[model samples]
Target: MSFLPASADAEFDLLCIGNAIVDVLAPVDAGVPEAEGLVPGSMTLIDAQRADALYGRLEPEQQTGGGSAANTAVAASLLGARTAYLGTVAADALGLAYADDLRRAGIFYPTAPLDAERAGGHSTARCMILVTPDGQRTMSTYLGACTAFGPADLDERAVARSRMLYLEGYLFDPPAAQDAFRRAAEIAHDAGRKVALSLSDPFCVGRHRAAFRALAAGHVDILFANEDEILSLYEAADFGQAAAAAARDVELAVLTRGEKGSVVFCRGERTDIAAQPTTLRDSTGAGDAYAAGFLFGLARGLAIAECGRIGAVAASEVISHFGARPEGDLRALAGV
Candidate 1:
């Protein structure tokens, strides 16, 4: 059987796989947390009942589409690349909303709806993001139907159809999703395409350090991480050591250090790109946006340094907005 899609013999620009979630964002007064005795800036996973309890207490300001890899896919599509998304959601309103949102962003959606029993009883995955005055976000995620997303949910055809496959680290927390990650990597490599991965969060790296190390050494061609996540993955004392270790393992390693800009390592060559100046309104999608810019540049065969610059610009724009998804056309923003 041929690996390429029947419509085109060439590879798609990018294919992303991860959770399908809807983001419910709200602005809270600074002292509200202290008054309510809630911890700030931590991500807590809650069951449907607990999620409902929390949702009842807060006023939802807006609903935006989100999920780490999904956000990256959307940004990649907006940057004028052909992209596809793989994930799971129920056949409910939120799930339909997620599908519609990705479609509007010009990304191909190939997810199957969950069983009616699951959809009827549980809400789709939702992240309640509390944005504080200092431009930081605290997230509480309700996995809901997302937990049922596993290897069976992956589309083999889509994996073989892309030039690059991108996976998020958050999927590691769910044991059922691990096989899906392995499957995507195998399919992508079999098709002669590259596989990319993001270390989703610092705590996530800490949770699955050994598995991540093994994957980074063998399966991952491109790796995306921030200062904390890199440091956690390598158990390094600081950012410098972690960056050096990552460069040795992956074909290309891009590490972002907020305010200090970003660094890219490729085949023993290192390039540093400074962050573009912008008023920081929110830091939600900065990393995902950076990944989109870098991947877009890579797909276009741009120089490594140029890719880092494009990533920096993308990160800058997202930090200036309250949402993880881009507020404007990134292709025009990058002057592509």
Candidate 2:
């Protein structure tokens, strides 16, 4: 399973923390999103009842453990990085299955499912992703027990032992989770481990732009964002302005631009990486997969440009299929 050589100094090469959600995917007509009052290609929060109703209305094509950071953890594991995930699920069948899936993928998931009784009767989080013909997915997520994650759920030991700590922005929506991420960042910094963050969505950036900026400038060593998300974060006039702002904020910034490829800004240098060629099927986890490959490459001591190239390859693989994860041999596709 060792696709790439890695340093064994740390217990895990990358430790990811965020929401633990099961993704239920189904293809529907382009009008489905509008019919459900959901904007196309946007993620919206829904309640339990709403989630249940939506699930019942559509025939599911796939159900798998997925969350931005969790996806990155799984993909990174497939690429041979020692990865671990820390997120809250619930004491339910779906929750247990999610945990099992991560373990099966060779990624450690250290948190136990939250007890439903103690978690205010919240069940496992679920996301109903309705994909339109154009391969754009509209997500309706029920936070469920995932929002119960707090400082107590943070795996301090794992954060301190990992070589790098990665955070997902969606989880930062809750005040408790925000505190937990800040605490985790502190722990990683104290241990001399690098902290990376993914600006999960453009909506997320709008919700916490000030906080994200503060963390990027002080806590996070590496930042991941797509073009839209980065532009939103900086409130910049264009891509160039946004990239400059990101370079000034973090030690390294990996910005993905769908068909335009990605750019890596580090130490006042810019490395432009071309997007990998692939027949697109779904773009659901493009950013997550890219983060996985790029972070895995960094953990494996590859050059920055090579890291971006591997990221591009990983992202391409994910989008060339129906599922968020790669169905192909990622190692072979990456040519590692």
Candidate 3:
């Protein structure tokens, strides 16, 4: 695919849409997870009661805006992109906080909030991350009012004004969210903008492989996935087969392999990007941050090899910290 410079009149370099969540982080003893009947190093969906109960057990150390696409949006903004985000949040305290975080990150978050509490609907979504002594994170996510995201909730003007639209795979669980994303993708394409999709999880791919395949083949111009997710998408026997299959579906296929590195396939060419060296602190959000860097570079019309390098550098920064978003100066690190 040929690259185009973003029009000066464009309001946004990228527009990201997905679940809006508040992430609560805590450090706990190794035995704490087993005692609570929780699986370590796993992300499980929980109900409101389970969310409340598990939260009470955690002595949280930090709370920040986090979710697959939201994390990418924040990271992209930090990389000097004119970014915007669209995620449905309830008119609750956590929801308000999620908006505030995007503001601080220099990303515009359009608010057409639902009063979930008054309407007897769900509250804001939250992920409770429990870090063990081994530096492994156990996450319990409650996808609350973000499921209420539908076609009506989208910022149509923002979709048209942005140069690229990024969709998060996790939000595909809700039937309405699926419709909403499809609608957003159509608007973006109609306006001659690019559409990118991140296969958020391997399990998420397994759940909606058919829908994902259809969307990738039909609408998605840029595709992002880790090793396991691509395998799940095509049920391919190996990574090579999965990579080749993905290259056939999308205009640009970017696949990440932890520790080893990442590969990008575009215009019948492959580019290998070596992983940047860094201490393994926490692996959460590494892929999300990588996508942010890659997309930001693509938005700036940078070469594919340089984009991959920036992505690897961004992933390194996130993993060296405890959270999904970077805590260090990423622009300085990547030398943008």
Candidate 4:
């Protein structure tokens, strides 16, 4: 069997690096959390024992492949951009499923699975997503083998082959992963390719604020973040302050606000792009989808404003679905 399908023969337009996780989603009433004594809107990492305990308490409605950066890579590929993903998983059922899902979505999958001891004894990285009637999703994650991912996991050749390298802020949680991120950044820079990063979540920003600032100032050429994440990163009192601070640090800063739309800042020029109108469904992958569309636009040489528009449309489509992965051809949805 081919490692990469025939469709991946050419040099990729983008390469993504981060944890590889599978998402378990279930629909429940908004009040279920209060009744079950579970926290809503916060992702907590649990050990294998805890994961089993939680798994036993509920019914799993669906299983799908996910990870912040991996989701963006898959979405970008579906938008007709050549993409590759780098991450680690155990040599277990979930690992195979994750790889297959990326491959089927037209993304180049290059990471190998861990040994049996890692897969069975320790849980695979799994996110238990609880969706409410109001289209809100609360997530509980078990990092498991994902935390074991480190610098050695990176594929330097693949990094050099891509036009851009994209990373997620969540990777900073594991100290070992920092080396891999730095290595990928160096490789991408040495090869004259752009490097992009998504501030995965507000908690992630709070966890690695200093390091993130250093990265934003030096390594990251393109930066993506939502209002809350940006505020946390800069320790700013409001969104505007954070956006201005980010613009001064990076070559391009794309800041997204849920209902207000998104802002693109580049070369001292700031432009606001209106959000595409859509009935809200689940906001699970809105940020990732927005990053996908924006990256896709950049890869296709579209203007910054047009890129933000594409990002908004992509986000709108994902919010109208239950899963983090896009349900249809996003290129068609973006009218590209």
Candidate 5:
């Protein structure tokens, strides 16, 4: 299906789909990961009991809202794009907090909360992030009530009204959620809206490589991945091979190589954009912010190179702060 720009009267520029999770950020020494028997730089899905045990070990420095696609939706809104989010949450305190955070950030989140009584006695989803002084963040997420998300939760009119549908790869963990993604993609495609997908993590890519490949080839117009994730997706020996493989499936493929820079491949052309120079206070939401900026540029009909530059600038801003949320006006940063 061909990608189409949103009409002037469209309700939103972008719509994001993913889990809804609150982030509990804690600054810890480098040894904390080992102490907790965790692998550094990896995102591990934990049970509610494990989440509590991990939370008890680290002193929380701050609490913020974060979910891969939700974070991107917030960033896109901050960058001056009309944005919406679709995800599930229970009628609990954390769920309320998550909705409040999204609303306050100017994101349209219309998903009705699940009834508290029928929520399987679970709270909302949460991610416990341990940040090191060097700006590396390791995450342990408890999916919690978000696991209840499925195709039934999607609003078809809302999906059709947006110019683009942004999906998070993390949602592939559950079979029902995978169906939800496929349904959303079909709706977006039928409406002539573009669809983008992020290969959230290397492990996530490894888990659903075949499905991801087919989806990217048939439905996705823009594909996002990091060095390790793209390599894992193609089972390639190196980034070059992975990038080459990616170019054949999607019209646009954006590969982020932390610190080194990012590569944007469109059609048969490639553009290498440098990472903005900034102090790395935390790397928690860099990719999400980058996607937000890129989507904002695309919504505005900016050239591909400008889109990549805006993405780099947004990523730089997120890494310079302590959380995944934007601290300043990204529109001004991009000189839009």
Candidate 6:
């Protein structure tokens, strides 16, 4: 089997696959999500009409580039890792803007834009995130052109050259996208590179629990999930039970429990890292940023505890801000 730095040609530290989306964020009262028939802490898929309706009701405070995997890739790049993104967008204004933002952030996005003639009238994807007073973010996403992402988008050489392949569970909705996910995992594993996956949301876990469990058991080297998602994945009674179960399936299982902190399980060993203390703001991209920090440390060959600490520090910064993207230099904040 091929191994890392296999040819003295490995070009990147991380390759992330997921939907490419722009995020429009605004602070709202706790009741806004409920008033819009959305679960207070859940991410729900909506169409363009629904997205427009929600956007009209709220005053947008920030319109920035954001996607689960993209956010992680960006944060990782800022932390000094060579990161690349694989996803699709329409050949439209938002799509071009998204590409430009990623390039400016020092991320390599190599996916081809969808041809307008063949785009079926879809625009670039947009996610409307409503942050509540308690720092919880509720999302309504319009997938748009992202649904067109398929296995054909994978760049074989790019996958083979990455140290780790990071996947966002949100892209598994489309059958073709699932095929692409499996193909990417195969490429990474075939090259003896590790694969990391994030269970994007609890409801997302509910939608494909069986498939995700199988992927974690057979393909994933590192698994990231929040308390609710891990519990949902295993159908266990609590965190302990779920974590125990998760440890048996993946080489490393990382579980985040909001204020209680996070736990990492590997080879019968469990380490708990305290959440970094910070003034809470919005929790929109905390998990993604945490993954970025953890992966960054892993790429640098840091100890597991140090990796978790870096992740905690990265997460703390995102939660202390309003939008999903970081406002300052995360590398400076991480002291990497």
Clashes of each: 0, 0, 0, 0, 0, 0
Give a tens-digit lDDT track for model 5, residues 172-249.
888998899889999988887889999999989988999999989988889999999999999999899999999989
The lDDT values for all models are 0.84, 0.91, 0.89, 0.84, 0.89, 0.90
Residues 188-267, candidate 2: write the lDDT tens digits. Answer: 88887899999999998999999999988989989999999999999999999999999998889999999999999977
Q: Among all windows of ten consecutive residues in candidate 5, which has the lowest summed lDDT?
A: 1-10
Q: Tally clashes: model 2.
A: 0
Please list the residue runs of candidate 3 whose C-alpha ends up more than 4 Å from where it truly belongs after superposition.
Answer: 31-35, 117-120
Model 5 CA deviation exceeding 4 Å by range: 1-6, 116-118
Task: Report the C-alpha lDDT of model 3 over 34-108, residue by residue, as the tens digit.
Answer: 787777876788999999999998898878998889999999999999999988888888788889888999999
Clashes of 4: 0
By how many angstroms RMSD does model 1 differ from the true structure? Answer: 3.4
What does each candidate score in C-alpha RMSD?
3.4, 2.6, 1.7, 4.6, 1.7, 2.0
TM-score, structure 5 vs. true:
0.97
Tens-place lDDT digits, model 6, residues 206-273: 99999999999988989999999999999999889999999999888989988888999866589899
lDDT of 4 by residue, 55-134 (tens): 77768777888888988998898899889998888887888888898888888888888886644456568888888989
Alpha carbon lDDT at 206, candidate 5: 89
Error of 2 at 293 (Å): 0.5
Q: What is the lDDT of residue 43 in candidate 6?
A: 94
Residue range 281-322, candidate 1, lDDT tens digits: 878878999999999888887888888888888889888977
Clashing pairs in 1: none
